[model samples]
Target chain A: MKKIQILGTGCPKCRKLTELAEKAADELGIAYELIKVTELDEIMRFGVMMTPGLAVDGEVKAAGRIPDVEEIKKMIA
Target chain B: MAECCGGGNRLVYACSGGADVGEIADRVARKLVKTGFARPSCLAGVGGHVPGFVASATGDVVNIVIDGCSVACALKTLEQVGADMTHFVLTDMGLKKGRTPVEDAVIDRIAETIRIKSSGRVEESPASTHDGCACGGC
Candidate 1:
């Protein structure tokens, strides 16, 4: 199963990112475990300074801003 | 340098761009540090997305951002990370972008102005929250 991680502090954008990531993973039919990292220390461990960061399998794909659903699909896939 | 007071720290970041006003902004930030009114932090690190630096920008600290002009590159950089900052523009403070001279006197004046204006209790940014990343754009 793919480990899909969303790094944020539960802000509006963070929630949006979470929703989009789940949608992308579902559409791709990927077996994924969604993890939300809300702690600053945990988020920083991924070396991301921006909000609504996305990570796939322990690797950060985007940070500081929200990526479109299409872009998120690419990352998860 | 002021005995590391208990009420959190005042972290200063300067634009330090290529222009003359940028130079002034850089010096002003340093002067604030030297006078013990604030501490110097890295704007470049935040801009470069260094995790530790970005983490440090948040929390119980006051972020003072200095910009060379209305361009506000430094402010934008911090904003990208959803940092809450008190911003200042040299041009808005009556310093000409290219014409301002980088002098200790000028730096001192600006630093004093900032120290005075930024004085008092720590002002919490309306955007700051326990969870952090309060930009609200998401």
Candidate 2:
């Protein structure tokens, strides 16, 4: 299963990104676990200073923004 | 921040980009509001030159601009519309730029930092609201 984590402080954009990620993953028929990261120390551990970021399978794939649906699909695939 | 009285309310606008830092900033803001630490304001309204948003951004209510990168999209948007705000930048918070893995612990740390800086309060653990997707019609 693919482990997908949305790194952020649970803001609106973060929620939107999570929604987009879930949709993309489901549509692609990918088995993934989505986690929301809302703490500060944990976020800094990833060396990320921005919210609404994405980590795929323990690797930081995107940071500081929400990726478009097509791009997210490609990332998971 | 004071509650939205009359036609104006305090708000927070995050530059939620495609990168990890951007995502983190966006999520932190939402979580803060949901948890009662802050309120999610209107970014589009400020960007669109809405008078209500602009007026609320001023005065006593706190207008926070959280930006994922130094590009400062959120701050710029508020600035363009003459909205005064307190700002936080992920890059300035000491997170290195570039693609990095997203970790729950890291996010916690970011939220904690904001909590400390803004009001010296740590966030309580989030409740098990739901595990379904936001698009699941919840």
**Model 1 stretches astray by more than 4 angstroms:** A1-77, B1-7, B123-138
TM-score of 1: 0.56
Q: Evaluate model 2 with DockQ and give the value.
A: 0.02
Per-residue alpha-carbon lDDT of candidate 1 for residues B33-71, written as tens digits (9 for 90 to 100):
666566556888888876545755663457889999999
Candidate 1, residue B27: how far the Cα is off, in Å: 0.5
Instruction: Give the CAPRI class of candidate 2.
Output: incorrect
Using Cα atoms with residue i matched to residue i, what is each candidate's TM-score against the true structure? 0.56, 0.49
Model 1 residue A31 distance off true place after TM-score fit, in angstroms: 27
Reference-based lDDT, each prediction: 0.74, 0.63
DockQ metric for all predictions: 0.13, 0.02
> Scoring only chain A, what TM-score does candidate 1 earn?
0.97
Worst ten in a row by lDDT for model 2 chain B:
B1-10
> TM-score for the second chain in candidate 2?
0.72
